[model samples]
Target: MRTAYSVETVRGAERELMGRLPEGALMQRAAAGLAVACGELLGRVYGSRVVLLVGSGDNGGDALYAGARLARRGAGVVAVLLSPERAHQGGLAALRAAGGRVSDDALRDIGRADLVVDGIVGIGGRGGLRPEAAQLARAAWESARVVAVDLPSGVDADSGEVHGDAVRADATVTFGAYKPGLLIDPARERAGALRLVDIGLTLPEDAEMEALQHADVADLLPRPVPESDKYRRGVVGVVAGSARYPGAAVLAVAGALRGGAGAVRYVGPAAEAVLAHFPETLVHPGPPDKAGRVQAWVIGPGIGEEADALEEVLAAEVPVLVDADGLRFLSPQRTRERTAETLLTPHAGEAAALLGRGREEVEAARLASVRELAAQYGATVLLKGSTTLVAEADGPVRVNPTGTSWLATAGSGDVLSGVTGSLLAAGLPARDAGSVGAYLHGLAARRAAGPAGAPILASEVAAHLDAAWRDVTD
Candidate 1:
């Protein structure tokens, strides 16, 4: 599992780790890894010109010290000090001893450099980069390949917001652990490639955020035994679509069938359309409450005017996943009163409407928005977009890594809702179901798009989900 910690938690751990080690031991460990990564990026460290954007923080020290190591290896290294007086004296001295010189002309030095190291701001930085730092950053990006130390300068470490000008690095060398901003957007776009350098700090078991890899998803994936029967494996009830948008019902049922659930019971006016596409589904005409026994229920995907079903679905004591039109009819009080887990799947526009905020606001502040929605609704929230975020109140937010831009189709969200609801039926926790479903949903889109990078329909994503499951479990 790839995990991230908050700025405060990381700072506390850093303090604890530093107290046990020698005065400069931790810095040396970080610098050594930084120098090695820079060397690899440059290919030939000898004769390559490297520029360090030195600031008044430990990030500046790391860059300067790494520059000294490169200088010793015959690389022509120059340090551009943004704050010459407050810069790390020990690091500066080491650079001088190893034949690295400080330059006053930031633009010229950055333009000619083979690699530019961004040390202007650390994780604690806010309000983007300073004017002078931003100028140097722009210059470096225009000419040389830049490597950011820790996080890309100017992005919020906790919320992943780039309020102003920030560094656009070719790669970022992070120490200790990853930050939320590195994994999230629009700050995530600033960090091109990420490399974690272990400086040996024991972080808490409960991380602020996590990205599930194949192994993690596989572990959470439900499997069946030989003794398992249809009802024993679990049945997921879906209340979706109407006469106008019967395709939504079919697509939702398609995803549920392949979601490791033994059975799918669909309740809606689109039974004929759903049965025509997916005959395996147990279809009901209306009123989801009377739709037989089910371990879990998925409500609202193109239910448009049929919001009455939302109440019937909520009355069931089983875990429920509400999406699309269902989210519109939902209230915090409705979920707060329920004892079973409730998962809310909403796209940026829907989430924005729920909070009475603008769509752009929700899109820009996805991490914060997801957290707030989860807290307010008292449900696990899957905020779908270019990058999918799954959050639960008082739990580490899970960022889905396998998402592709191709999954941004009209009915893709309905498929995700069904898949996650099926996982809930299979007895996965609300948080795990949301994370795994998003992972599988994204992976299926990638597979459907193929290596040709062609466009795919929502139906193709549903079709390729079994392949995605194999890819994960294999």
Candidate 2:
């Protein structure tokens, strides 16, 4: 697991470490690690031109001290101080003593440099780059290979919000722990590649966010055995679709088939259409209560405002996935009454309805919304969009990396519900089922739409699920 801490947590950790060591020790350690990384980028420390975009805080101090290390190694290093008067005195002294030069004519000479280090703002920064800093960052991005310290300047280290103009770095070198902003979208895209350096800071157990590494995902995936029979593999009951939208039923079944479920029992008015499309599916034209025994249940998809359908599924004694239209009729109190696990998958629009907020409001603060939904309903929440977020009731949230804009097509979400439901039926934990299912769903979409931008149908995405699973596991 790749954990992310809040800016406050990082600052507290830095302060604790600073107090335990001698004066200037922590900053020196950060600077030395940064300098080594810069050296690797330049191939050789000697004869390389290095430019530092210095800010007013300790962030600028880190850059200056790192630049000093390069200067001592025979590299031509220059510091472009954004706030010369407020810059860290100790760091500035170290840089000058090591033969590094300070220049105000940085913009004109910046293009000639081999690499640029953005130390304009650390975790303390609130908004994007200030006007002057923004101008410099834009220039550096256009010409030089940029490396960021701690995080890219101008991004909200806590929320991952890019207020205005932010630095887009070729690589970001973080210390101690990852920041939530770096793992999330918008700001995540700006952070090209990530590197973590241990500065011996102990993180709190209550960190807010996390990302799953390959090994973690591998451990979470379900493994089948030779003794597993059709029922033993798990049976999924799907209560989705209506007369108005029968296609959703077909797409949902398509995803369920790709999942490792042995059988699917579908109950809805669209049973005839589902049977016609997928003859293997066992269709029942009845209510959810009489749908028979299933290890897990998937509800909502194309279901309109049918309160009976929603209530029946909610009362089930098995793990349940409530998505799309099912989200409309859900009540937190009702969800809490259930004995089995409940998972909620809502796009921004549906999430807004559940929270009684605007769609834009939910999108802008997706992290908060997902967490709030989890806390409110006492269930795992999966907020789907550009950056799909999965938050457990009392655990750290996870942001999925594999996604594309093409997934916005209609019925894609329905497929996701089915796949996740099947995983739940196969006895996987709610969090793992939701996260892994999302990863597979996104990869399948990418595979279906090849390099030439082939138009992909929802069924085609389901067809590629097995290939995606193999790619990830292999």
Top lDDT model = 1
Candidate 1 residue-wise lDDT, 55-124, digit = tens: 8999999999999999999999999999999999999999999999999787888889999999999889
Flag regions of model 2 displaced more than 4 Å: 40-48, 72-75, 204-206, 305-307, 449-456
- Which segments of model 1 are wrong by more than 4 Å? none
lDDT of 2 by residue, 26-119 (tens): 8888898889888898899899999999998888998999999999999988899998898888888888999988976988768888999999
Candidate 2's TM-score reads: 0.91
In model 1, state the lDDT of residue 282.
93
Q: Best by TM-score, which number?
A: 1
lDDT score for candidate 2 against the true structure: 0.87
Question: What are the candidates' C-alpha RMSDs?
Answer: 1.3, 2.6
